[model samples]
Target: MSSGTASSGAGSDDDHAPWPSPLIRDLVDELRRFNRRKTEFYAESVLEASAFAIMLVLSDGRARTLRELTEELGLEQSTVNRQVNNAIKHGYLERFEVAGSLSRFVRPTDTGREAFHHDGMLRAARIEATFADLAPGTPEGLLRELRAFNQAYDRRVLRETGKDVEATGEHRRYG
Candidate 1:
């Protein structure tokens, strides 16, 4: 018997061949994942961008406790606390205490809104435009999906309250 790596096999692009190159869809997905990591890394260095996305998700015109934010972010409380503190320090978030309650609310300040939009949202919109060329579906289809979701969210918000102040607020609260 000849010595060779069993996993590698004789190189062939057949379906049964272990060495067959990854399928086109798999390759595309891989590239997308890689791009996401690279973009996140770049954004992390930008301070405001690192926190903007999380803050925007949190400040969807609703109050979320710090524990809730930590769970949503998949981060430790200390980490969330530090970021929240920085947000407060930077005038991006304000702490709301209900006195003797474990739940404390953190809401975005005006400056936070500006920083979030200028830091991450602006970049994301431009990048999203570029991503239109990456996937199989047309950009129009993706936009339609977004609009549908937005409409659904709006309906829910309106149902909950007579007035809807947008589910995701007008801007991201940089935290």
Candidate 2:
């Protein structure tokens, strides 16, 4: 949250340094903790953010097929399928066939949803804690900035893998 400017030795009078935002380092560290060498939950470490993201979009709490998950995540069908399979095996998800469709539908079980809810609340609390002393308008400004960042993220995912997936904020799934 340090907004103060610093000048590089490269020497302009301008205080605009070209340092990468600390947010990047912070995020990497946090995610690395989840995948640290000592971690026992390999499945959680491998679970695709996109798959969990797809679950979040299922406001109805009904099952969705890989096709539906892929569309929601703006990801490839195979990627969605693989992640769904992994999730199912982990007991965080279950699959059932649609009445008329050949493809199987996936839904998070109660345990799965509980885990998702826990992660969501933890993240929300962290964000709130991070910005606790900011002014009211600061939160809104940060929200706007985060939205802009996500648009850029979506663009990058599309560029790197031809996917336009998206997610944000309190990280809530359905009710």
**Residue 122, candidate 2: alpha-carbon lDDT:** 55
For model 1 the TM-score comes to 0.55
List the global CA lDDT of all models.
0.61, 0.59
Worst 10 residues of 2 by lDDT: 166-175
Per-model TM-score, in order, reads: 0.55, 0.52
User: Pairs clashing in candidate 2?
Assistant: none
Which of the numbered candidates is closest to the native, going by highest lDDT? 1
lDDT of 1 by residue, 43-162 (tens): 433345446755666556665777866766657989988888887887888889878887888877777766765666556665688777677776678677656755776677777876
Q: Which structure among the candidates has the greatest TM-score? A: 1
Candidate 2 ranges with C-alpha deviation above 4 Å: 1-51, 136-175
